[model samples]
Target chain A: MKKKKSSIADKIFVACNTLFMIAFVVITLYPVLNTLAISFNDGIDAVRGGIYLVPRKFTLENYQTVLGKQNMMTGAYITLLRTIIGTVFALVSNALLAFIVSRKRFLFKSQLSLFWVITMYVNGGMIPVFLLYRNLHLTGTFWVYVVPGAVSAFNMLVLRTYMQGLPDSLEESAQLDGAGYWTVFSKIISPLCKPVYATVALFVAVYQWNSWFDAMLYNRMKSEYTTLQYELMKLLSSVMQQSGSAANAAAAGATASAVTPVSVRAAATIATMLPIICLYPFLQRYFVAGLTIGGVKE
Target chain B: MARNTKTNAPAVKITWKEVKRQKFLLFWAAVFVIYGVIFYYLPLGGWIMAFQNYKPKDGFLHSKFVGFDKFIFLFQDDTFLKVLRNTLGMGILNLVSTFIMAIVFAILLNEVRSKIGKKAVQTISYLPHFLSWIIVTGILHDALSTSGIVNEVLMKLNIIDKEVNFFAHPGFFWPIVAFANCWKETGWNAIIYLAAITSIDPCLYEAASIDGAGRWAKIRYITLPGIKPTIMILLLMNVGNVLNAGFEVQYLLGNGLIKSVSDTIDIYVLTWGISQNDYSLGTAAGIFKSVVSIILIVIANYMAKRAGEERLF
Candidate 1:
């Protein structure tokens, strides 16, 4: 129905809301576009200012520096391996756990699930966990990424809830055919639950890709084990220190002869975000379903 | 999920055959159970260090017992108290501002006429939520640099003669953090409220319009009350994390100059406890955080239930 009163205040509110949303769109896009522009801009020209939305002078030197930086190949290799391997490991382990606890024939069902649910509510904080890993000799090793996070309790509950919603007749029929638990899970439950698996896999991949705190905590002393995020963290922190003092850059006049701090940081930001920008949009539809199912603790 | 269903239906005899049949699944369960106990439960035992003069050489058993001393010391210390204040301040700032903005955005978005325009704005807004904080804070650092775009714009508008180094000033830290958090999360958080608003009965609005009530009046009387449950549920859930103000942004953005305000409990643990090799003190601090959080969430959920609001537990 159309507005009956059509009062000036209602019209003004609509206009104001429209403007606010438009402003929001600009604020969201500006940083990404500005970062993109700076990444392509020549270091020297970028520092001279007025490089708003487009490159003043185009160059690829920043990426080259990033790719060629010390031990970057190791970081990239570790990051790639961790993302793929870690996501798969987590999904498989958590899915198996979920299936066990979800089975109608399975005894101790509530107790089995409750064992994991408690861990979700309480954690032993960082240092204890760190010390535990240290005692296990998991520190300064690549397995730290894989072994510790193999089965997430939250993802287990989500997958279990999703699986439990499926027809029991499907499993009963499979059992009548003499199909084993693993067989039914592999052939039927696994394929039928692709949506939830995909959702959890996406979450795990993103977490692995975004994790630098673990790297910093466990592998900071081990130069060979630096992940891509930790590498970027180091790069960003160093450049931020340098760029914090603007006068030093102007006095040094080092932008032309060397890559400027802003451009390098921009390049680093772009490098870190490229994969996310490429992957997240394709998987965006799964986000709401994932969040709701994951949050369905009750 | 239905444990009694099969047991009550079949009345199958408990025998070695049934045990053999389920052995494989239970064997599978054993693997994760062990992993959980090792990774999740083992460390919980380490919290005992909070009550000890823990030494790496002596280990857990031999560490001299200093029962409740560390906690008393923690409370007596001014630095711990200050970080607690900082954490609570940032936490409350984030809670109120983010909730208000999300609700506002949801209401306003529901008012949009053009479907395309509304979808485009929402899609753009979701970009920041998925991005890494390192990237976001990097963007902020560049934009807030002395010669950055923000300073350039402010100077052009003659807001100040000189540039403002936002990170250098402790006074602006909380606002910057709160606003940035709102910018990142508002769109994502609004999705639930939008879902709530969409489910609102159209008949109410139609009746309000038939009675000559305007858009604002309909929204005030119907749409808000319609979405009150969603708001209550989210607010209750968030109360569980009231102490978890934020770690990533403050840790990344914090420098020595702004340490007074930027040093959250997480940072305090890292700098004063872990960095100084005072593991016992750090464990004490961590235990204190854990205990207080558990208490807060329990009380919050209890109050929510008492008020007939949405309770997380």
Candidate 2:
């Protein structure tokens, strides 16, 4: 709410804020638009510089080159597969654990919670975890992703809090009817917990989609197991090399450079980025509620 | 978890039927405990390798137990100390900049009158948060390149004589990473604060205006004080992640030339323990980081408690 009499300072502040917001919007949008421009522009034109906002000498060749690269399709398929299966597994295990413990009929609730909560305070750090995964012989295997992350303590807690908020009479009626735990969970609680479940599901899905570090750490040089993010990372690293040595390459002789790696790298960045951007608008409604649930403790 | 009045349900305690009925559910819950034990609790034993002359073949069991030798060696190493310096330097810088920027963004966004404009800006800004760091760093690398837009625009505007190799210089490393972090996270970080601001009663603004409070005065007094608890809670929580200045960005953006200013404890552990085959030393470095992190979090919680702010625990 503002006063009816707007002061000169208030007018100045409003003008300044408006200007700043416009500049802020441009600052945020420019790089993304530039990257898009580079991805579409002719490779030579992109490398020679001065391309911004819009494509210069536009071509789809960069995308073709990026998509046509070795193991590109395979990497996409792998990322898709892992994201689906991993999110499902994580949701099932975490939600079940949360729901089961949330039931008052089940004693040892505090102890069950404490067993997992202790993990939040202490960890073996990266080295030991890596070694443990190595010792388990899960590294370099697909199970490495699914098995370790099946039960996220944080997700479990969030789900538990949500489940706690549901009216008990619903479950009590089902219990009186001699409904089994699985029946009660499926026929009643599952329908009731959709919002929080969707929120947690989105978190795991995003985490699964974006993760490259685990694949890098565990899978090592296994190209077959490469994720989309890892493929993009590989492309980026190669672009770095080319950017560094393009001048050297020209001096040493060879005018056969059809497409600079920079263009393909931009294309690859967009490819890796496209999934999140496209899905984000639809999922945007879920994020604020998700973040609040995740950040705030009951 | 249900807060129902179940006192009228007839106390049917210590019944065999109930135990049989509940056994399956309890067993299912116990599976989580089993997984937690195997995945989390067990690896803690591997921290013992930090105190050993660890060799892969021998493992922690057969390795010669050398107490704090690796730690002393880590402290004695100049490179390791410099890595710590770079880590703390970048961590504090990022924390301060991002914290202020996020709050400022929240305050500014709260000042906007148009709902559509506010929502549109907020949506577009937090869009970066969904992106993986690998992608974020790739964008940074592209945009900050020698012949990239930054240099191109600067040179055209007669701001510079030539293209600046931003990544090549160690002195620019901390600020580059800090700004990159601010770009990616500031808007998203402001969301909670905006929610805090919205929760402040409109009557406060109305009352302040009647008292001849300007926009700046109201923001300084009412708006700020409303979000103080939220700010304190966030600060206390983030203090625990101080050591995690992050691994991916530094590892991606850094190279041998800037290694002096780029390496953090995570990078150090990865390079030394895994890559260099010095598992013991890496574990020692990791253990040092973890211990200090735990201490910092405890101290932060204590301070919050003393100040009558929100304590994490």
Candidate 3:
């Protein structure tokens, strides 16, 4: 009797687990896939009926329109440049700071660490940051993106913690082999810290990629150099606002003729998000391990 | 003890000498110090603009001093007050909903013993985190539009007599924003908790099973308690950022019609700082927000310490 009941319970457990897992998969994948379907669907069809899981009438016209727009392509180029330059500067600065802070024997390490931590808790906020950019003459320039957010405190802490976990014996052996501290750090420590470096690199890259707020705040000469996300936001907001105004006009007994190109907007969204989404699967292994390591307390 | 101290003297001396010899360490340290001084500390000095009627042309030092006027103006402004309320309301909603969903998702995900199934689920969920908020807002635009999928589905099901204007209505705006936040972030946020869940000893589950405990009982008695520390730590750390209610989504989703309910402190700052060119008022608001956040963090840390849990400090 006990054996039969236990088997039945086990079967129920497995079935429940499978059901939950499938639900999670569906909830996560559906919205993204839905967006993709809308992006591919013909604009008119996409608007008339909701494109859910699949495209009703498949088309790449939306992509062509978004890409063919000279402004968006220019924005993409600017964003790419910013990401590359910002990541490099951030990574170098962060790695150097982490190395210094990781050395327990270094004087004022604790004080410096506290300083960095305090920055994480408190900031001068956006306006002051804007003023600072203005003072430095960084606004409306490429340096606006790269210089202001060159180092992140959280990334520094993560790198420092990762470095701390490495055995001191490695540095000691390098010292015994007549290598200087710089040489050891460059030739030995950095190579060993690849996984953490890769992790930090990915974090910085994503930050640069998704960042539009900085551009929105500082870069007023939008025609000169807007980031990809910012351009998309502008486009989306404009369409929504136009539609809103049209509705108001109609409510006021005026002819509301302005139509929001919903398909074009969806296409722009899909286009803007395409590179990162495609890059995600490749970075999945590192991303999961990095997140797990970073979140797991020592 | 005397012999041990005498023997450690040479090691200590060597360590001191090594530190002195490594001038390169000092070089790199100085480089970082310079970076921080220029970028981090200098911007902080710009906070003085909060006390001044800051003009871009007048500059920080030359700006006319009007101490506390901007802050006073902020407190008196109805729009500012509404923004504050909206920020806190949306933040609290996001906090509660995301917290519940993350924990539930983590628990459910933990039950999956199939490797491939778990991996696939994880990959799909984590994808949204990589998406920019702009794109997410775009998705929401389409999904919640009058002729959008959500309304279509609802109408087909006879749930509503007419299309609901999900975005324009102030009452619905906050919830829609919160729901979008939860949808975008829950899976990614659950990851930390899921990692915590895995670290729980399997032997505890075995013991529960031996005691004839069912799955729910095992979860309550064993799993919940095990991940409680992780949850508490994350919650405390996040309390400092409650005012951040997110900028991009709220900004993108907000319209003039729903602005009263949707404008957050960040949006308020952006408006004053960028749109009006009243940098002083914006700086004042920003400073106020930052100060409150710091206070909350310190208090949270102190409370967590008293409770004998892991604190950010």
Model 3 lDDT, residue B189, Cα: 88
TM-score of each: 0.94, 0.95, 0.91
TM-score of chain A of each: 0.93, 0.93, 0.87
The candidate that wins on DockQ is 2
In the range A1-298, model 2's lDDT, one tens digit per residue, is: 7578899999999999999888878878788888899889887765567787889788998899877887778778888989999999998898889888788777666678778877876889888999999989999888887889888777887888778778899998998999989998888999988888888888888888888998889996788888888888887787776554447424322455456677777888888889888887677667667666566421
Off by over 4 Å in 2: A244-257, A296-298, B1-18
Q: Ten consecutive residues with minimal summed lDDT in candidate 3 chain A?
A: A251-260
Please rank every candidate by lDDT, starting with the best: 2, 1, 3
B23-93: candidate 1 lDDT, tens digit per residue: 87889888878889999999899899889999889998999999999989989999999899998899989
lDDT of each: 0.82, 0.83, 0.78
Which sections of candidate 3 miss by over 4 Å? Answer: A1-21, A244-260, A296-298, B1-20, B56-58
Lowest summed-lDDT stretch of 10 residues in model 2 chain A?
A248-257
How would you class the docking of model 1? medium
TM-score, ranked from best to worst: 2, 1, 3
All models, DockQ values?
0.53, 0.55, 0.46
